[model samples]
Target: MTANRELDDILRRAADGGRISPEEALLLYTDAPFHALGEAADTVRRRRYPDNIVTYIIDRNINYTNVCVTACKFCAFFRAPKHEEGWSHPTEEILRRCGEAVDLGATQVMLQGGHHPDYGVEYYETLFSAVKAAYPDLVIHSIGPSEVLHMSKVSGVSIEESIRRIKAAGLDSIAGAGAEMLPERPRTAIAPLKESGARWLEVMEIAHNLGVESTATMMMGTGETNAERIEHITMIRDVQDRTGGFRSFIPWTYQPENNHLKGRTQATNLEYLRFVAVARLFFDNVAHLQSSWLTTGKDVGQLSLHMGVDDLGSIMLEENVISSAGARHRSKLTELVSMIRGADRTPAQRDTLYRHLKVHWTPADDPTDERVVSHFSSIALPGGGAGGRTALSVIDAQ
Candidate 1:
């Protein structure tokens, strides 16, 4: 058989919902025609979601601290311990942010931040328990396996015990923050100080067994090859096959700015879109796929709706990590709905677990409040330009 014929067969099988092997996924990701690959992924999405409805989540990313022990090469958000700029929000300030999120109709809070050397499980326990006590209606889909590992080591406890304690302290679910790239070479190249990729997955598996669900994420464009990208997905797939703990697969591009890795290389628009389609086709076992407009532009995000991206992700009341790394894209609730409608898909607000909370069937039903915008206080990056302060933190005196 010809090589073209083999690629065609793989595309057909993927479009029909057949599980594609990692090798087949790489072939489609690299060799298949762009439109053909996207079409196949769109077919899969329509099959799973016959309603033709796209979803977005209203959530705030509450960065509790900017002091990190593992300062990654690709990150522009972390400051070393005792650095003049390093700061941790007091428990009262963190709770106040949660209160603002609740008032703004945010159903979830992603409390992610630097791995502070001083913050043990006790710190998170106090913070999370306080948030739950104040807002029981909100979902606390915060932290990741890396944070869990950090806390375990900090407190001298087992990983299992750490997860159990956090779950008891009101950690409803885990977000895939630290699973940057699961492949060893890329994972180490970017974040060598972090826990190993295997260990990250192990912590997640333990959390799953403990009955705490979570999401899986991949950070692309850190100079990894096509094969490594597929391998990253394979790692998550293998674990998902066992625990079924991952709720969604979120793949985003790496922003290169004000960081050690520098702006040497980044994922192109074509590469990102292809990965989105390929991710949808590859992870048949995973129920939902989210597109990241925070890193990628809105056009790419809106285009992803037709290319197998079911969720547009959060409005992100505040996001400092990616913004600090030079991601300039921002959106309001109204603009988000328009983007969905412009793509010809009905817009629906969803919770952390991909559950639809509100659906806007017509223009009249859409939200008009403009304050629900991304990055309420724009981040003042290293070089500095606009915006007075970083996200989820008190705005510095202008």
Candidate 2:
């Protein structure tokens, strides 16, 4: 009875927008009823966006180079910088992708890559400049704190200076890549060569203070403890309290296939839903919480809508990183809107900042543009990229 009352108290506190400590969050995650978690989280989501409209983005993840110096064991997409198969796409080639994205009604382009031994700040500055010059309208929401740290080291410049230069050269915002698990022990176990969780937040703080906002992400199921999971979000919430620059919080499970950390530890669907619910309760200050349909299937993604996720990630035109590891979920613009609709929420297309571009209140209102698709594996990455389709080639029959 005492334990049940504890769960009841936590749910009540969470539903009322009260802050749950790491211990309480862990408790709720481990014991609270699933639907209760969902109900409380849904209450929070509705409070955040009373319009009852769910949002999604039209974008493509462009992996500029798969050649990496930081060979994190959990990654399957990165090739050693000297590997024969490694390559880097030319500026013109990347520009062609941006052109395709713009034509397909994509407003954002996610530019992410591994830590190339020689590519420094100038490498990114040039790429950003070229992409922006070609498609000034597309938001270059690219890179992350990890890239910034690596480039700063390669260029022998300050992190602040690197961020300023890149933003000056068309880098609009940072994506929360390389932030696998921000806690120390698990992060070290998974990615020894990557920046520390503190350092990652430090770099993000610099970007935020510099006016370059970004989205925060978590890569779960990396053998981290439930307490550690709460620790991760606790860290993010602390940083957000100071910076207020993270536009959204996105959580996705790790794909442990071809990577070194092979399928040993993966979070279950119940675990994911519990985490999502707790996140909405804990991250009251963060404006948006997005679900990863790319990592979790469309069903789980839709189910997440009732569990506090206000946004479905994107109709990714291209995604090479997770595909190399085994994330095969895929959906087109229409299909994603339909999925959201089936969940009993209206669908809307949003940009990087969570501003709605188009809203579909009725089934007939969904956009009919065939080219607006989750075209992850349609085209082979002729330049330096990963093999296998990014949007799960397994379901390519679509």
Task: Please tell me which predicted candidate would have the highest TM-score against the true structure.
Answer: 1
lDDT of each: 0.88, 0.86
Sliding window of 10 residues with minimal summed lDDT for model 2 = 389-398
TM-score of each: 0.95, 0.94
- On the 0 to 100 scale, the lDDT of residue 71 in model 1 is 92
Top candidate by lDDT: 1
At residue 394, candidate 2 shows an lDDT of 20
Where is model 1 more than 4 Å wrong at Cα?
1-3, 381-398
Give a tens-digit lDDT track for model 2, residues 171-268. Answer: 99999887889999999999898889999999999999999999999999989999999999999999999999999999999998789989799999
Instruction: Return the clash pairs for model 1, or none.
Output: none
Write model 1 residue lDDT over 198-242, tens digit each, in one string: 989999899999999999999999999999999999999999999
